[model samples]
Target chain A: MRGRGKKYWLEEIIFIGPAVLFFSLIVLIPFFIGMTYSFTTWNGVNDEITFVGFSNFLSIFKDEGFIDSFCFTAKFTVVSVTLSNIIGLSLAILLTRRLKISKPLRTVFFIPNVISGLLLGFIWQFIFTKGFGAIGSLTQIPFFKLSWLGTESTAFWALIIVTLWQTSGYLMVIYISGIINVPTELKEAAQIDGANHRQYFRHIMIPMIMPSVTVCLFLAISWAFKMFDLNYSLTKGGPYNSTKSIALDIYIEAFQINRYGTGAAKAFIFFVVVALITFIQVRITKRKEVEA
Target chain B: MIRILKNHRRIALEIVALLLALICLSPFYFVIVNSFKSYKEILIDPASLPVKWILDNYINTWKELRFPAVFANSLIITICSNLGIIIISSMAAYRLLRVKTKLNKAIFGIFVMAMVIPFQSIMIPLVRVMSSLNLNTSNIGLIICYFGFGVSFPVFLYHGFMKSIPISIEEAAIVDGCTSLGVFFKMVMPLLKPMTATVIILNTLWIWNDFLLPSLMLHSRELYTIPLAMNGFFAKYTKQWDLALAGLVLSIAPMIILFLSLQKNIINGIVSGSVKG
Candidate 1:
């Protein structure tokens, strides 16, 4: 009995040791150290750290860049989540129909997801500046000629547009799986009751696919909140910094400007905000999900 | 007559969906077409096909960007990171699932909870941590950083899949006097192949496309990955659209080709990954 227990102990250490070790070394320790740094005004280098309790946190209220960036991230999250979900669900509905082109269309839609958001931002930058310029000239359409990335509102919409283009397909893939798993019996029963197309869709289809809705909405909300790469490369958080995401704001604070203490505090706040938001979203959607 | 009308409606919807796909692909069209055109020609009519196809842009960018070196760097980082994450997380997940003790449960909870800790949050002190450990410059350092950040999701994925696997076979294998590690590698590991594909595909997409972690860890020119290289290229040559677009093509070509080859598995992996939870 003792020997068998000893063998089990050895196996446990060998199996689980590396994961817990790396997890603590990389994530756990840095997190605690970051919490410590958030108190002191440590300037990332030159370790002469002065402790100023909550002063960095206090300053965040007056730091207009961080405040604006938070608000911008919040607003961007709301709009992109709503828009992407709508477009993605629509595409899923369209493609799941008995269409000849569903397969190719799915491929086309998902192509945007394969490339890095950084590269896509660059690709779209060219299309907006050069391609839009030429198309505007050829067609003489004022819509294409407007300086897309020059102003505040258009730049906001530009971020929103690229985001929709990038994520809607990924979401569509999830929604399609959701739609496919809806039992056919439910559809037949709805048809037998003579439910109109819209009525059937509203009452039966939506309820049957509530699980997909849960996952899709959860995915969309979290993605919209964590958006950094696309926002970074697309606008560079420019046109008066109106498009700066919270992630970008944290990066700029720590790395670019050398305010390690303030960056750490800001990151802690960002973490809390993200956790709270995703928590609420998942709770809400989880309630709506109906088991198949 | 009613059936014919329904068929017509389906065909019309297909056409509308195809048109939308084309609209979705317009940026790709503009980027690919403009890439092959001369600077003057691009400005003349970006919508038009190149009057004189230009090979110089691709050739110049290939040499100037040091395409092979950056490509190798990205491939190494992604491959190494995925391998580490898979092995470490799978082993932990396997044990954590088999042993139903309170301590193991708490550790599993910690791993799962860390999913919400975005990379940007801990990245400040993570840099400090890596620098202190003297891991800031090498590909190995960046790969380790990925292991830390990337392990949580795969562990969660594997834990979920491990629940579906029966324990009877392993117990029987044990009765045959197969050693513990022998049963794990010989029996359990082979059964893990389907979920293994999911872990590999999803993690490959993520670690390959990640820009920020590598951007933080890698400082030297020789260590730059594709995203980092592209970022530097754009900063230096923002005005040189011809070479810039060609460079973009070079950067994204590998992932696109990989997608084309394994799209069935790619799409299948995503579906199972999402639905598994």
Candidate 2:
């Protein structure tokens, strides 16, 4: 018994030690250290660290830029989440109907997702600036002529359109798997009951694919909230910081502005909000999944 | 007559799909076309085809960005980080499940919860941690950071996958005088190929395109990844549309080719990875 126990211990250290060590050093320790830094006045370079009370948190609330960016992020999360899921699910339904072109079309939508968001930002910048310019001239369409990244409103919609273009394909794949797995008998039975396509969709299809809804919504919400690279490379939260996301805002405060303490505090708050929102989202979706 | 009606509907569906696909592909078209145009031509006739095709843009951008060096950096970082994540997560998952101890369960739960912590939250202090460890500057250091951030999801995936494998196989191997490590490698690793593929695809897609972590970690010009190098170029030459378009094309060429080749596996992997999670 003693020999077996010793062998088990040795194997445990050998198998699991590296994961724990690296995880702690990289994630766990930094997380706890960040929490402590939130209470101190550390400028990220100095060896001297002075502990302050909740002043950093207090100041973050007063920082209008932080508040503005938070609101912007929340708005982005709602719009992107709702629209992406709707469009994605719709595409899934359409493509799953045995359309001959569905396979290649799926590739078209997903192509944006494989490329880096950073690069996509640059590519779309040209589209908005030059491509739109060219199209506007040839067609004389007022819509294409609008300054996409110049104003707050158009810029907001431009980001939304780009995001939808990038992610709907990804969401479509998940929804496709869900729609494909809905047993054929269920659809046949619904039809036999004299249900029309819309009725069958509303009652049977939506409920059946509720799992996909949950997954897609969770992913969309998180991605929208944490959006940085696209926002950075495209607009850079431009037109007087009208489109700054919380992640970008924190990055600017901490790294660019060199306010490690305040940045850490803001990061902590960002963590709380993300945790709360995702937790609530999962809870609500899990309930729907059970009923379905 | 009914068959004709159904055929009409299918044809209509095909047309609508083709149109949408065209709109989806328009950006790539503009990018590819303009990449071959001269700077003066790009400015004068931004919408029209180039009067003369030129290779100067690609050649110039290639030298300016040091494409080969940056491409190698991205490749090394992605491959090494993926290997690290897989080994760490798979071994840890195996141990945690096999032992079934309270400590192991708690450890697994902790890792899962860490997935929810936004990178923004820990990133500031992570710099401090890395600097203190004397590992903030090198490719090896960046790969180490990837292990911490990237393993949580893969570990979760592996945990779910490893649950289905009958433990009796491992016990039988042990009884037959096989070492534990040997059992894991020879018996268990082969069974994990599907999940391994999923892990590799997702991590490679992520780490290769990620601009933030590399931006923070690698400040030296020689250490720049493709995205980082392109960002530097744009920051310097925002108006050089001719060269910029070429750089964009060169940077994304590998991903486009990768997608064209392995898109089926990638789509399947994404579906399984997300659904199971």
Candidate 3:
């Protein structure tokens, strides 16, 4: 029994050891150290570390830039999450119908998602600046004439628009799976019951797919909250930082401005906020999910 | 007449969907069309067909972006990282499922919890940690970081899938003189092909497109991946839309082709992966 136990232990270590080792070294250790750093005044490159308790956190609350970024991210999250889910759910409904071009259309919508966020931002940057300009002049459309990424409000909308374009298809896929999972028998029964399209959909399909809504909302919220690459290449959080996400703000703090301590504090705060929001969102949505 | 009306509505819906698809594709159309036009022509009318299809932009951007080198670097890193993730995570997941001890369960729980901790949260100290461990500036270092970061989701996926796999088969193999490693590689890994495909498609898309982590870890120009390279190129040639669009095309073409060819598997993989999640 002793020898057998030793062999079992050896096998377990041989198999599971690398994952635990890497996960600890990469995620666990750094995470704890980051928590420690949040309370100190250690510039990223320095040995002079002063333990200032909560000053980093205190200063972040007063920093107008940080507050603006927090509000911007919050507003961005709300608008983008709502729009993307609506668009995605609509697209999923449209494509899942008995249409001839549904497969190809699904491909078309999802193609943008395959492109990297950074590259997508760059592509849209050209579109907004040059492509939209040329289209605006040729068509003489005032709507297209506005400097899409040049002004504060329009830049905010531009970020939202690009995010929707990039992510709606992904959410569409999730919703498609959700919709398909709704039993055909239920639909047929509703049809026999003289139910109209909207009634059938509202009463049957919506409840059945609450699980998918949960998934899509979770994904969209996280993506919108943690937005960085798009912010970087699209507008560089620009037209005067009106569109900067908290992720970008933290990045700029640590790497760009070399404020590691305060950045760590902001990051910790960002993590907790994200965790709390997602946790609450998931809990609410999961409650509404029907097993059928 | 009623049937005709229903058919008419269905046709209208199909047309609407098609139009939307075209609108979705319009950006790609503009990029591809304008990429072939000169600067002045593109400025004149991005919507119009190019009068002359010029290869100059492609050639220039290719040379400037060092497309071949950066493309190779991205490929190597993606492939290596995916391979490491598959091996390490699958093995760990297998053991975690089979062993089922309090410590193993706790470790698995910690892995799952780490999923919610966004990269920005730990990135500051991660930089310091990497520097101390001499992992801050190489392709290998970046690959290791990916191994760490990528393990959680794949392990979670594998853990869920492995529950359905009957241990009787492995037990049978053990009785036939197969060692634990032998049973895993020979018996268990083969059964994991579907999950493996899902894992590969998901992770490849992520690690290939991932910019921030690679940017943070790889500071040297020569080590830059495609996204980083394109970002630098865009910043440099900010107004050179002609060459810039071409660079964008080149950067996205490989993944686009991969996606197009394997779109069925890719789509199915995404559906299964998310459904499981």
lDDT of 1 by residue, B1-277 (tens): 9999998898889789989999999988888888999887877788988888889999999998999999999999989998899899999889999987777899999998998887778999999999999999798999888888878888899898889889999999999999878887888778888998999999998889989988999999999999999999998998689999999999999999999889879988988887775
Which 10-residue window in model 1 chain A sums to the lowest lDDT? A1-10
Off by more than 4 A, model 2 = A1-4, A290-292
Model 3: which residue pairs collide? none
Inter-residue clash pairs, candidate 1: none
Candidate 3 is graded, for docking, as: high
Residue A57's C-alpha lDDT in candidate 2? 94
Write candidate 3's Cα lDDT for B28-77 as tens digits.
98999999999999877888889999999999998999999999999999
The clash number for model 3 is 0
On a 0 to 1 TM-score scale, where does candidate 1 land against the true structure? 0.98
Candidate 1 residue runs with Cα over 4 Å from true position: A1-4
- Residue A41 of model 2 has an lDDT of 90
Top lDDT: which candidate number?
3
Give the TM-scores of the predictions, in the order they appear.
0.98, 0.98, 0.98
Model 3 alpha-carbon miss at residue B209, Å: 0.7
What's the true lDDT of residue A191 in model 3? 92
lDDT-sorted candidate list, best first: 3, 2, 1
Residue by residue across B43-110, what tens digits does model 2's lDDT show? 87787778998999999999999999999999999999998999989999889888887778999999
Fraction of real interface contacts that model 3 preserves: 0.83
